[model samples]
Target: MITPAPNVPAIASTPTFTDTEIKPSQTIAANTTTPPTISETLTLPPVSVIATEVPPVKSTPKLANIEWLTKFRGIPGIGVNPVDAWLNETGTTSDPTCRDTRSPSCDKHYRDPLVDNWAAIRLTEVKIVFYKDELEKLITFSGVGSSISNWFHINRVLASSWTTLVGRTYGYFSLEGDAGNGQRFFTASPYQGCTKDRIFTLVITKQVASCAFDRHSSYPQFLFVTGDGWGYPENMTGIALADSFAILIK
Candidate 1:
């Protein structure tokens, strides 16, 4: 019976693996987590922008009341003998007469109470000029201080006076023009600073007037023409600063 026992191969037993045990030939998979999905989106309000503007400024001075200028009685075409009347009104003694032999004219100088008392300006002398025919030709207001401090007050007074007489404001840009009749108005100033010579003139005669000191040919002559507007002669030098204002009448 022993001999008869066939030599059968011994059967191998199957191995069992525990939960923490891993076989050498087996591969283990890594643990992965699922991602969460978003449901809503965020939004913001839009911004806005805006713009702005501005205005311009003026450089000229304000105009003043010039009623005092019209108060004078010595204005041309006023009295039978305007020169004498003006002298009487101004209470001036005709002691020192302004006589020019070459030119057929007579001039009387005086100090006017109205001008002296005027708070607006300080004028020392007023002169009345007459032609050979004894007709009033020119009335001049003069004697401003030569100081620069007097410029503002003087300018204001003259400007106001011009505005009152001409019915228009005095501007450096528009100095002279035809003021009706055979008359012409002119305004001028010197280029120099701190000088007290300025003149505002109104030519009242139809004929050309002698601006010369005498009948000398070398002297200047003033010719006034009529039109819409007229300007001073180009050859004319110096601004109208005569420290005086003259009104010539017919």
Candidate 2:
């Protein structure tokens, strides 16, 4: 330390630094070890690929023809809804095999009388009622040779009433609206042409029968197919005839 003169500030000593030597925490040896080489090559079996063939498309019915009448309305502890009333005591039979005392009564048989069936029956008035929300449609009617049949021409659709006819009625009539505008109608047929073996579907929507009723009508009605001398040949060979019908709403 040096002495300071009077009224002069003493100088402070500063620390000096030089280059320092640094060493690693531990010395590592060079890796002289080598992985063992694969002495022999492995062989794999050859694989064979097979091509798959696709089958041809076949025709089938368009609608969901359920066995509704037998399973619901006429069964034990079951009956038609209050809104539904049968105008004809005998319902039409598209296929006689499905006909039984348990089936709804109608007056027409799509089955030919010569082909072992009951007499052709006729119907007049009918009523189908349901809650407005419960109707998503898909209601279906069955018949033979009706695959290509004009569903809308079966008969005139009307409003809910006591004298409603519900069966094959031959005539051209108009409903209040088209499709979903106010009313809608849909029909489907099997992929195959109408023979004794083929079945067709007839659908009626919850549209307003504005002829006698208003657009706010809750029930839609149908008439019977009274016109005759139409449809497929009554007699055929090995037709495997089977006619059935069902309707679903809810």
Candidate 1, residue 210: lDDT: 34
TM-scores of all models? Answer: 0.22, 0.18
lDDT of 1 by residue, 166-225 (tens): 333343311123223232333334322213223344323232333321122321123221
How many clashing pairs does model 1 include?
Answer: 8
The runs of at least 3 residues in candidate 2 whose Cα sits more than 4 Å from the true structure, single-residue gaps closed, are: 1-12, 17-230, 236-240
Best by TM-score: 1
Q: Write the per-residue lDDT of candidate 2 for residues 1-250, one digit (tens) a residue.
A: 9988678677888655444623232222224445456553554444432222445578785434422232111111122211122212223334544344335543332222221221222122221221112221122322322211222233433422212224433222222223342222221222232242111111123433332211222323221111121222113221111122222211
lDDT of each candidate versus the true structure:
0.30, 0.26
Error of 2 at 213 (Å): 37
Candidate 1: list runs displaced more than 4 Å. 1-104, 109-111, 120-225, 232-250
Residue 47, model 2: Cα distance from true site in angstroms = 39
TM-score computed on alpha carbons, candidate 2: 0.18
